[model samples]
Target: MREQASYLRIADDLRRRIAGQKWASGEQLPSRAALAREFGVSGAIIRRAQEALITDGVLEGRAGSGTYVAEQRKRCRMVRFQATGQAGAGYRGPDLGVLGEGETWEGRSDVMTPAPAEIAARLGVDEGAYCVRTAYEHLVDDKPVYLTTSWEPYDVTKGSLVVLPDGGPLAGAGVVRRMAELGISVTRTQERSEPGTTNAEEANLLGVQRGTPCTRIERTFYSDDGRAVETADIIVPSVLCEIVYELPVSRS
Candidate 1:
């Protein structure tokens, strides 16, 4: 068997100390150099240990300030009802809360954005095709919790009442109802979710450590003819919410 890395050993010890109340929640930790000297390990090892803890939500980094214990966060349960004709049958409920309660969001739309390769492929459109992209910031008590960016092929709803997702007579009515306004019937929804680390943009927008852990959800809405009408990326910070999917059994 191979020996464990020095950083993992250090990380384990750090967890023990935190568990034992050596470092209380929201309290800053000693400097990397100081910890390295005390542990008789290299600064790089200490840095790695702290980074691992940060990713696990056990600790957090402050820009130019240093590392600190993460505060206890009440992770909201973001539920996705997979069964048809059920209540809250959407990726995100009206509000982020478990029962669709207190939460607000801000949305902005860009109608002239060109679809990148991946997005174009998802929308079944050519690369550089014009698309309406909308970005949303979901917040609780004015504190940002998550984000959603949506892209729909321009040709699908151009020159219609639903051109701008956040605009139009049916504004904020949701994709299904909006498409229904355009005489388009949306039949199915697909999603794929994975764990990932936050990038610089996400970190800055979410007000978290640069390397904080997050859940990335790729979602697409399709019509009866099997055409993808819209696709979106949902970014949920790990410390803010827990995603739950309720899948009903098929009685076929």
Candidate 2:
């Protein structure tokens, strides 16, 4: 066990070195044999340390190439339900905090799709019910940061200009504003978040390795009548973002 402990210590030291900028982003790391010699450890120990860094997203390996320092990932802040007074072209803009500035979002909306069972349950609608779904990818400096999928019951939005989230005069006006146009007032929202691992699709979208740690959030918007106006799933890489929730305190 002592030998195992030594490799972990070596890994921690290597991480510190990387954080200290001993090797710049995209710069190839020293060979395993070299690292082993420098650390007075076996090549296996050096390999294990490098593998740990690769999994943590601090380093990346290229086919037919050596491992290199990964590009610095921006730490985006995802604020839940905190209106930013910001409007985008095709979706309700999020309270991205510091990341809001200079950030660009691209999205696609599809109407009259059958709602999946999980989405139906969240919206309190029958399984296979038609709904409008929109998928969004948020980017910073032209790099994908996060992805979101939102669903709204078709019965409520059918035949309305706002049925397509990215269409009509109120395009991207947000759920609250769009619902208000139909005399529905969104009074509250609920969100649940948990840790998750990236799948192949998510990995490709976010430019991270499969099994990378990520944050999964489920959010639902409720009207004054307690009807679910919209529900969405948000996926963000844990290494690149943090989720913050601010709750109001009641004064009796």
**Which candidate ranks first by lDDT, i.e. highest?**
1
Residues 62-105 of candidate 2 have per-residue lDDT tens digits of 77888899887778776543543233343355323235565777
Alpha-carbon runs more than 4 Å astray in model 2: 1-23, 27-69, 81-98
Global lDDT of each candidate:
0.81, 0.80
Instruction: Evaluate model 1: give its TM-score.
Output: 0.68
Regions more than 4 Å wrong, model 1: 1-72, 83-99
Tell me the tens digit of each residue's lDDT in model 1 across 149-210.
Answer: 99998898888888887776766667877888888988898888899989988887876777
